[model samples]
Target: MESEALGHTVMDQRQGHGSLVAVAEKLTLEEINSTGAISNFGKPNAPSPAAIVACVPKNVHVDEVGETEFRISPSEITAAIKAGLDFGGAYRC
Candidate 1:
C-alpha cells in the first residue's frame, strides 16, 4: 500500500536518530457538536472553512510526514465533501 511504503521511507530516514511518533485521535460526536458548526434549528447551517478547521484538535503529533498531516483535519474533510457536492450539482446542471 502507498501508506505502508511511505511509512517505510520515513523509518529509513529517521533510523538511529531517535524515536519518532505520530498520534491520530478520532473526534467524538460531542466534540463535533461543541464546535457550533451544527445548528439546533430544523435546517443545518453552513460552516465557514475557518470554523470547521477550528473544530479540529491539534494535540496529535505527526512525525516526518511533512505538511501532509493537515489532510486529516475536519476542515479539509469538510472541504472535500463540499467540493464533491459541488461537482455533483454541476453534473446535474
Candidate 2:
C-alpha cells in the first residue's frame, strides 16, 4: 500500500473484509463550506472572499477498508467549527 511505502505500519487488520489502519504524520484542511454556500450557488448572494486555512502538521489515524475514516485531533475539530462559523458569516448578506 502507499501508506506502507511511506513508512506507516499496519497497526491493525481485519479478515473477511479487507481493512488496514495506519497513522499519518501530517495533514491539512482543504476546504470549508456552509449550507448557504450550497443554496446560493450561481446566485448574487453567493459567498465570496474564500477563507484559506494554511496547511499545518496534524497527526491522525487513517482507517481504510470499505470506506475511509480519519481519526482527527480535538484541535482540528475546533478549527473546523471556527471555519464553519466564518463561512456562515460570509455566506450571509
Candidate 3:
C-alpha cells in the first residue's frame, strides 16, 4: 500500500512525461553461463549471491553485515516480499 501510494504521487507529477526506453533480447542459459559463474556448477536454478562475492571490493569490516549476509536464504527473501504484498491488499490472481 505504501509503495503503491508513493507510485501514484510520482505519476501525478509526471503526467505526460516520456522517457527513453531500452529493450533487451532474452538471453539463453548457455549464454548466461558462458560468463563463468555457473560454468562449473552445471545449470544453476538461480544465480547465487556467493558466486560473485569475490567481485565485491574486500571489506575490512565485512562482519558489519554478518547476519544479513549469506545466512539469509532465498526462501526468506521471497517470504518477506510476499508479506509486503499482503500489506497492500489480498493478492488475487
The top-ranked prediction according to lDDT is 2
Q: Each model's C-alpha lDDT?
A: 0.48, 0.50, 0.44
Please, what are the lDDT tens digits per residue for candidate 3 over residues 2-93?
76876754444344343212212455555554654332322236443443222323333456554333345567665765575556532322
In candidate 3, how many clashes are counted? 0
Which parts of model 3 have CA positions greater than 4 angstroms off?
Answer: 1-70, 90-93
**Span of ten consecutive residues with least summed lDDT in model 2:** 20-29
Candidate 1: tens digits of C-alpha lDDT, residues 1-25:
8768757544555653444333114
Question: Which pairs of residues collide in candidate 3?
Answer: none
List the candidates' TM-scores in order.
0.23, 0.24, 0.24
Off by over 4 Å in 1: 1-71, 90-93
- The candidate 3 region of ten consecutive residues with least summed lDDT is 16-25
Clashes in predicted model 2: 0
